[model samples]
Target: TKPKSRSLCMANPSAYNYTTDIFTAAALRWLETGRTASKPFFLYLSYTVPHAGGWGSWPRAPEDGNPVPSDLQYAAELSWPEVERDHAASVSYLDARIGEILRELERLELSSNTV
Candidate 1:
């Protein structure tokens, strides 16, 4: 197996910002100010979640490699184990990011033209 790469920002506060948040913000920013309406624009966005070791699992305890941001989106799942709750939270976070992007598209009048 190939060695997993680690994030250089693992120790930074921004490291906990989460991949979905970062990508969604970038997508929104581009849609708002970085694009030209005179020509077609192509944006490719991919999110990492419901996957192993987010940010290379930096937010997790040293012994736990599967990590999610320390967010409470699933904190109400008291019956679930912490790891499972974290996973569920991450998935929900991804869904929210997608919704944000879609909303931005609609706001920008790009949904019908976008694929």
Candidate 2:
């Protein structure tokens, strides 16, 4: 079945920022609602980083200076020198957010009983 929310930002190759935003939000929600006494909660927090069309794809004209027209920014046409750097940064941002959630779990003493 198709997803109910087209909210999967990872599908947008140019929007790693969007993917990170979604991951963090979901992690927060999972932490809030996933505590139970009898069963271990399983969270599947999938991230769409280093996906297609992200900063990992190509460097567009700067949004503030000498910006190219929107119509001219093609992923197939541009060569970005820092694609790996951009991907790494995106991954790091999401990792940090996950760390925050794990820290909260530890603080609440949920790791021992619930994991």
Best by lDDT: 1
lDDT of 2 by residue, 1-115 (tens): 3344554535544443466666766677677775754567767777666454545334456433454456865534444357655776777876787788778778756666654
Q: lDDT of each structure? A: 0.64, 0.62
Q: What is the C-alpha RMSD of each candidate to the true structure, in Å?
A: 10.3, 11.4
Worst 10 residues of 1 by lDDT: 54-63
Q: Residue 8 deviation, candidate 1, in Å?
A: 4.7
**Candidate 1 clash pair list:** none
lDDT of 1 at 89: 77
Model 1, TM vs. native: 0.58
